[model samples]
Target: MTEERGDVQELSDFELAVYEAVAEIDKAGGAADIGTLTAQIDRPEEEIWAALSHLVSANHLHSTADGYTLGPHDWAP
Candidate 1:
């Protein structure tokens, strides 16, 4: 399927936090590892993981051996 783009503008607060956490990892040149995300979002691990799962289902994120990362279409306006 084609990639999604800029689809998170209307995300809920929790999803937005998840996006920001992922963005932080991207900025740091690392994957959105669960440990990194939990630290960045300052939330419980399970909560962050649930958000990440939603992101994955929504096509805003992808998973790899390294960890989760922003999907290709995430930056689209």
Candidate 2:
């Protein structure tokens, strides 16, 4: 679910951070799983899960059986 261009700004800071975490992991040739996200983000695991869910819903991140990755969108900050 790719969000529209105008909706890109609707992403919250934590959601964006989650998305960036996935991006970084993908860049490093790794999948952004719960453990990786938990290690990279200082927040509690529950908060990280919430942010990841929001990011996936907002189309900023993609979730697969492996883990999360950057979603299909062209928008950049």
Candidate 3:
């Protein structure tokens, strides 16, 4: 399954990883902080940050004071 939000036609593997990290955080009733994401996702912190940036820019993720979470967009498969 794929989603289109703003300029995003499809999600790259890295982006999907970042998104899944956030979803896992949500499931645990926690926030998607850099540290937590770093541990949850095998990728380097820089790559995670980059993917987060892309997801945010695409409006698929939003930043809160606590950390990152899904935006208005629905990414459910």
- Choose the strongest candidate by TM-score: 2
> For candidate 1, lDDT tens digit of each residue in 1-77?
77655457656899888887787777778888887776667778898888888888877888889998878753433
lDDT of 3 at 53: 88
Stretches > 4 Å off in candidate 2:
1-6, 75-77
**Per-residue CA lDDT of candidate 2, range 1-77, in tens?**
53443265787787778778889888777679999889888889999998887777766677889898877766452
Query: Estimated TM-score per prediction?
Result: 0.77, 0.79, 0.78
> Number of the top candidate by lDDT?
3
lDDT against the true structure, each candidate: 0.77, 0.78, 0.80
Candidate ordering by TM-score (highest first): 2, 3, 1
> Which tens-of-lDDT digit does each residue in 15-53 have in candidate 3?
987887897787677779898888877878889889988
Q: Per-residue lDDT for 65 in model 3?
A: 92
Name the lDDT value of residue 36 in candidate 1: 72
lDDT for 38 (candidate 2): 90
Pairs of colliding residues, candidate 2: none
lDDT accuracy of residue 51 in candidate 3:
91
Identify the runs in model 1 with alpha carbons over 4 angstroms from their true place.
4-6, 74-77
